[model samples]
Target: MTHPDTRRPSSLTAKLAGLACLLTLAPLQANDRLGPINITAAREAPAIAPAMPETVITREEIERSQARSITDLLAGRAGLTVSNEGGPGKLSSVSIWGQSANRTAVFLDGVRIGSVSAGQSYLEHIPLEQIERIEIVRGPRSGQWGADAGGGVIQIFTREGTEDGSHLSGGIGAGSRSQREADAHIGARQGAFDYSLGVAHRETDGFDACENGGPYTPPCYADEPDNDGYQRDSLQLQAGYRFGEGGHVRVHVLAASAEVEYDGPTNNSEIEQRTIGLSASTGRIGFWQLRTRAGRHIDDQDYFRDRHFDSRFDTQRDTLSLANDFFLGPSTTLTLGADQTDDKLSSTTDYVEDARRNRGLFAQINTRLGERLDVQAALRRDFNEQFGTANTGSLDLAYRLDDAWTLTAGHGTSFNVPSFNLLYYPPYCIVPGLCFATANPDLEPERTRTSRAGVTWTRGPWAIEATAFRSSADDLISSPPPSYVPENVSEATIRGAELAAGWTTDKWSARTSLTYLSTESEATGEPLPKQPRWSGRLTVDRQLGAFSLGTTLRGRSGSENDNQGYVVADLRGSYRVAPDWRIEARVDNVFDRDYEVVDGFYQAPRGVFVSLRYGR
Candidate 1:
C-alpha cells in the first residue's frame, strides 16, 4: 500500500550559518560549575566518591546542544556504539563494550522501560522537552539492576516542579527532511504538592530509500519516494507531595503514539505503536524505606506485504515490584527487592500464542571499611516458568588514593531469556507450503560474566577517567542451519577500553571521549560482526551574554566487516531575544557524510532547524 507524502522541509544548514553569524557579533561568557550528584552512593555520607566512567549530561548541556532525541544527546558518550536500523523513528540500538543492544538496560526515573516484543528500547520516543537530566553508568550493573544489566545502564530523570513558583514554556522548530516539532511544559507548586506536565508533537519527511545489495548506481531506487518519514506524539505528567515530617509520595503517567512509513524493494511498509504507563512511589519511616510500583506496557505491529499476505503481532507486559532499604549500622546499608512480570503475546500467523511469567528476589549490601575505602555486594535469583531458575551476583570495590584520584574494580554476572518471537516465529519458503524457519522449545538463556577496573581523577576544572573491561558469554543464542534452533556454539569473548576528559573554564568548556573494542567468537575464533573497533567524540561550548554557541565533532572507525568510518560535525546557538523569549537554531551533518551503521540502512542527510521559545 502507498501513502500520501506529508513530510515538512528541513532547513538545518541555513539556520546553522545564521547562528554562526550571530556568534561573531556577540561576546561570549563563561560557564558555571554545577555540583555533581553521586548516583552510586546509597546514602548521604562525607567525602562522596564519584562513580568512575560515569557521564552526566546536565540541563545546561542539553539546552546548548539542541538535541531532538535521547539518541542525539548520548551520541558522544564513551564506550557507546549507536546505530539506527532504519532512518529516524524506525529502530535504533546501542552497544556498550561490544555487547549486543539487548544487553543494555534503559530506565526512566529508575524504572525499566523497554519493550518485551524486540527486547529493545526506542530512544527517539522520549521527548527532550520533558527531560531534566540523564545519567549514564558504564559497565556491568547486575547487582543493582537485574537481567540485561550486563552492558551498563542509562537512567533518565524528568523535570520536577520547584518549590519557589509556577511556570509555562513552549517552543516550535522546523528542520531538514521536512521535519517539524512543537513542545510545551507547565509546572507549579502549591502548599505541599508539586506537579509538572509536558507534551510534544514531531513529524518528519525523512530521506529517500535505496534497495539493498543492488548497484549503488543512480536510477536504481531513485524513482522511489524521497521523504518517506514518520510522526510522533507524546504526553507526560508527574506530581509529588511531601508530608509534614518524614514522608513523601509521587505519581507519574506517560503516553506516546507514533506512525511511520518506509520504502522497500517491492512494496512500502507502514507501522504504528502506542504506549502508556503509570507508577507511584513513597518514602520514609524510621530507619526503613519502602517502595512499590506497578506498570503495564503494550505494543502492536502490523506488516502489509502483498494483498494476500499480511501479518500482525500484539505483545503486552504487566509488572509489579517492591523494595526496602534499611540501615544496619553506621557503616553499612542493606536493600531488598522483589519483582514479578507477566508477558502475553498474540500473533496473526499460525504461531502459537504464549504467556510467560517471571519472578525474582534480590538483596544488596553497601559497606564502608574506612575513610578511603568502600565496597558493595549483591545477589539475585530469578525464576521464569518457561526457562526455570537462574542466579546472578556482583561485587564492587572503590579506593580513594587522594583528594584527586580514585581506583575502582567490579565483577558481575547477568543473563538474557529468549523472547517469544525468537522461539515461535514460523518457517516459510518459496514454495506454497515449504518451510525455511522452525521453532525450538528447548532454547536456553544466555549468561554473561563481566569484570572491569577503572581510575578517575579530578584536578582544578579538569576531570578524567579511564576503564578497561572484559566479558564472556555462554549458551549464546544464534541462528543456525535447518531448523533455526538456538545453538550453544555461539559463545563470545569481548574486551574494551574507554577514556574520557572534560575541562570547563569561565566562558569555555570542552569534553571528549575515546573507546576501543575487540570481540571474537570463542567457538569459531572469528571477530564479531557489526562492531567497530574505535569510536570517539569532541564537543565544545561557549556562552556570550545573550548568545550561546556550541560545536561537536563525532567519529566512528571502520567496522570489521568492510564498513567505512565517517566524521560528522554539528553547530548550535541560542539567543535571548527578550527577557521571556529566546531563539535557537542548529545545523547537523555539516558535511553530509554518507555513512551507515547497519549494512543496508541509509543515514539521514544534512539538516537544519530554527526554534523560538517563550516562558513566564
Candidate 2:
C-alpha cells in the first residue's frame, strides 16, 4: 500500500505560504457569546451535571472543520475515538468511551496538560491556529480531575480578547500536501483593559508516515518511501484586567513548535509545547464567588536519527487552583476546591521516577429540586508523592419527565497513575538490544468505577442527547512482549452507548451521532484493541446570503484489532469576497476511502483546500 500522487513545495512549503492572514482569521474572542470555559463540565456554571455531558468545540466548529490537528478537531467528537499513527502531525491515540489512551485528562486553559514521562497529552502538538474553544467531559473525572481521571476531561482555549473594540485580523491558506498556511492577529478593549495577540503557521508535504512492517513490528523495517514532512509554529497571548466592580485579572500564553518526518528509528522528531496561565476573579468576596489559578506546563521532546543526536524527553508542569463559589439561592450552588500539582521529568533515557507531587481537595454541590429536579454532588481527596492516597466520588441526577422529557443518573470514581514509563523504563539496559523496553516496579494503579444513564429531548429546533455507560477497570495495565515490562494483571469491562441529534433553522444546520462500544478482558475474554464497535456522525450546514455550506459524514464499525469497516466524507465552502472579504474551500477524503484507523498506518487519500480572508 503506497500512495503519494504528487509532491513539491518545500522550501519549507514555500516559507509556510507567507504566513499571516492572522493564520486564517484567528478568532480571538470570536464575538464572545460565552463559548469556552465550561471547565470541562464542573467547578462552576451552576456546578454542572445533568448527568454530565459537555462538549463544545466551537470557533465556529473550527472554521467548520477545515481542521488540521487538535487531532483534526477532536476526531469524532462527543463519543470520542481518535487514533492516528500517520498523516498530519502523526502519533496520536484517543479513546474515551472505552477508556484507554492513558485514561484521558488534558487541559490547557486551566493548566493540567501532560507527560511526566507519558501519561498522555500531545494531541499532536495542539494548534488549530491558536484555538478558541474546546471543552469535553466524558465520564469519571476523578471527582475533580486528579490522577488521570479514568477517561474524561479535556479543555483547551487560547485566544481571547474583545469585549468592546479595537481589532485587526488576518488569514492565508493553501492545500493538499504541499499544504501551507499563515496567520496573524491583534486585539484590544479599552477601559479596563483586554488584549490578544496571535501568530500561526503550518506546513505540510507529508504522506508515507509508516509501513514496511512485520519482522519485529512497529513502523519502518526500512523501505523509506520518502515524503514524511510537517512543520508548525504557534504563539498566543491573552491579557485581561477589570477592577473594582466584580474584579478580574487574567493572563495567558500558549506556544507551540514542531518538526516531523517519521517512520521509526527516530527518523526525526522535535516538538515543544507550553501553556501558561494566571487567573483571578472575584465578586466582592463576602458571600463568596472567587477563583484563582496559577499554571505552567511544558513538554519538550527531541529525537533524531541519521543526523546524529537521538533522545531527550522533557516535561514540566506546575499548577495551583483555588475556588470558592457559594450562591445559596437562585437555585443553589456551592463549590470548594484546592489543587496543586508538580510533575517533573527530563531525560536521555534513565528514569526511575524523575519527580511527582500532587495534592487535591474538592467538594461540590449543585441544586434545584421540586421544579423538575436536578442535583449534583462530588468529593475528592488525593495526595501523592509518588503514588499514595486516593479517593474520588461523584453523583449526579436530573429529572424532568415533561416538556419533552429528561432523566439522568450518574456515579463516578477513578484513578490511574503509573507512568515514568510505567514505573521507570530503561533505568538501565545493556547488551545487544536487551532493552527495547522494560519497567514495572510492581506496577499498580488503575482503579475506576463509572456509571451513567441519560435521556434528554427537546421539542423545537429539535435536539436530543442519550447516554448509557459503564466502566470497571482495576489494576489493568499490561506491556507484553519478550520483555516490554509494565504489568498489573488486567481487568476491564467498558460499556457504552451514545446518541446525539440536533437541528436548527435561520439558515439551516444539522448534526447527528451514534455510537456503541464494549471492551472486555476480565482475564482474556478478549476484545479490546483499537476500539470501535460501531460509530457514526453526520453534520450539515448552510447559511445563504453571504454564502456558506458544509457537509460531513463519518462511519465506523470494526476493531478488535482492525476488522475492516470504514466510511469518510467532508466538504466545505464559503464566500463573501467583500465587506471584510472571505473565500474558502475544502474537500478531504471525499469518497476516496481506503481506511484503517491504525494497523500499518496510511490514510489521507483525497484532498483539496483553499483559503483567503480578512476580518470575520
Candidate 3:
C-alpha cells in the first residue's frame, strides 16, 4: 500500500541539487518592501527573516480567495497537503513535508489547542471568519514550541481592534447543497483598552460522501443513499490593555461547536472546542524584557450510531509559560523560556492512564554580523511523566548574496510522544477467546531531523523563492496489517523541492507554486502511502474600480491510491455596491474534476456560493 523509491540519490547529488537552485533564481538580489513580519519562528520576536521556511496568509489574501474554511485556503500552498474524509466540518488534517497531521502542532493566538488523547488537532472545527492572519513555519520547531512540532507549526491569530472608533460588520451567504451562513462582528478601542467580539453560524445539507453500493463494492450505508450534512457555530472575543511604555496585557477567548453527519453505523458526530488565554508583557527592565502566559483548552466529542448514543471523549489541557529576552549586544539577543502543561482525558472506554504532564525549558540566541549575514540557534529539553525525557535543537543561517538575493539554510530536530490511545488502550479480543492484542506502553517517541536550503530573489513587485528539503525520522510508530500491533520502524525519509513566485502590477497580480516530493521507509524500502509526488497551484486576480475578479487552478498528481493527475479550477468575483456594502460570489471546482483525496471518499462536487456584506 506504500510507494517507495527504488533508487536513492547520492549525498553529493542531494547537496548539488540544492546548490543548483541558485542558477534558476533569475537576477540574484534582495528586496525588503514585500517581506511580512512573522512571530512564530521565535515566539516573541517580529522578524522579517527567520532561518526556517515559512509562509503568511494575510487577511487580504483570505478575503480575496473567499475560502469557506482554513483547509480550503491552505490546501495548495507549498510544502503542505490536506486530506479530508467527507465534506465540510468532517474530519480533516494537514500534513507538512509528507509527515502525518498529528505531528504538526496547531496554535490559536499563540496558545496550543488540540486533543492530548488522540495527539491530533481538529482543523475543521476552526472558523476561517474569525482569523486575522495565519503563520505557517515548515520544518521541525520543537526547540521553541516544546513538543509535537516534528512536521511544523501553524499559528492562527484572531481579529483585534486596531482603531479608536467603534464599528459593526456582518455578512450573510448561501451556497450549493443548501448551505447558509451569517456572521457579525463589533470592535472598538479607547485609551489603553481595546476589545473585539464576533459570532458566526453555518449549516449545510451536503452531498453523498461515499460511493454507491455494488457486488464488487462495499455498501455506502446499510440502508439507503444518504447525504452527509454539517453545521457549526463559532464565537470569539479578545481584549487588550496597554499600560506604561511598551507594556500590555491581553486576553482571548474562542469557542466553536460542530455537528457533522457521515455514512456508516456511526451516522453522525458532534465536536466542541474552547480556548482561553491570558498573557502579559512588561516594559524592558534594564536590558531584559519579560512576558508570561496561562491558557486552557477543552476538546469534547460525541458519537451517535443508528439513532443511538455511542460514546464520548472529552479532554482538557492547562498550560503556563514564562519567557525573557535579553539584549546581549548591539546586534544580538538571547531568549530563555519555560513551559508546563497538563493533559487529562475523560472517555467512555477505559484506559490504563488518563492524565499526563510535561515540563520543558528552552533557550535561543540571535546574532548578526556587520552586513549580509544573520544566524539563530535554539535548544530545548522536555520531561514527560509518561516518556521520561527528550531534547531537541535547531540552527538557521541567512546570507545576502547581493542587493536582491538571499541564501538561507536551516537544520533542526523534533520529537513527538505516542498518543494515549496507542499507548494504553485496553486489549480487544477478535473471537471471544481466540485472539487478542494489548496496547504498547513501552512505545518510544518519534524523532525527526530535517534540513533545508534555498535561494530567494525579491525585487519590486516580483518575488521568487525555491528550496530543497530532506527530513528523516526514526522510531516511526505504525500498526502493520493483520496483527495491527503498534511498533516502531527503523527510519523514514522524506525529500522535496518547493518553488514559489509572486508578481504584482497596478491592476492585476499573480502567484504560482510547484512542489515535488518523495518519501521512503528504510525498514521496508518502500515509499510512504498516500503522498502525492507532485502538486502545483496558480492564482491570478484582477482589480477594476470596485470590482475584483480572480481564478485559481490547483493540480495534484495522485499517489498510490488514485495514481492519476487531476486539476480543479475556482472562480471568484466581488463588487462593492456602495461605501459600506458589497456583493461576492464564487464557483469552486469549475471543471468538476472527479478526484479522490482519500480512497473511496469523493471530493466535494462543483458548488456556487454568493454572499452580501456590510460595514467592513
Worst 10 residues of 2 by lDDT: 5-14
- Please give, for residues 1-616, the per-residue lDDT of candidate 2 as tens digits: 1111000111100011111211111111211212233656765443545545656667767876667778766665556788776788777757688787788888888788877677777687777766787777888878877778678888788867765787777689898888988888787888889889989888888887666653344434345677788898888998999887477888898888988787655577778988888988885566677888899898887877755777888888898988888878777778888888988888777676698888999988888788888787888899887778899988888798887778888889889887777677653322245325546777878898988887867666776777889888888886544354667757878888776767667797776666677888788686666777766666678989988898866656667656465667788888887988888898887878866567666777888989887875
Measured over all alpha carbons after superposition, the RMSD of each candidate to the real structure, in angstroms, is 6.7, 22.6, 5.7
Regions of candidate 1 where Cα sits further than 4 Å from its true position: 1-50, 212-225, 244-246, 265-282, 305-309, 428-440, 480-486
Top TM-score model:
3
Best by lDDT: 3
Model 3, which residues run further than 4 Å from truth? 1-34, 46-51, 212-224, 426-439, 561-564
Residue 587 of model 1 has an lDDT of 90
Question: What clash pairs does model 3 have?
Answer: 3-527, 4-526, 4-527, 29-404, 29-405, 30-403, 30-404, 30-405
Error of 1 at 296 (Å): 2.0
TM-score against native, each model: 0.87, 0.32, 0.91
lDDT of 3 by residue, 1-616 (tens): 0000001111111111122222222111122122544678767653334545777777778888899988888876787878666678766778888887778999899889888777878788788888988888888889889788988999999989878989888899999999999999998999999999999999999877766553223323233367888999999999999987568999999999988887654567788899999999896777888889899999988877755887788899899999988877877878899999999999887878999999999998888876878888889999999888999999888898887888989999999998887788665432245433535788899999999998877778888888899999999876654455677888999999887777777787777767778988898776666567776677789999999999977666666444455667899999999999999999999978776666655678999999998876
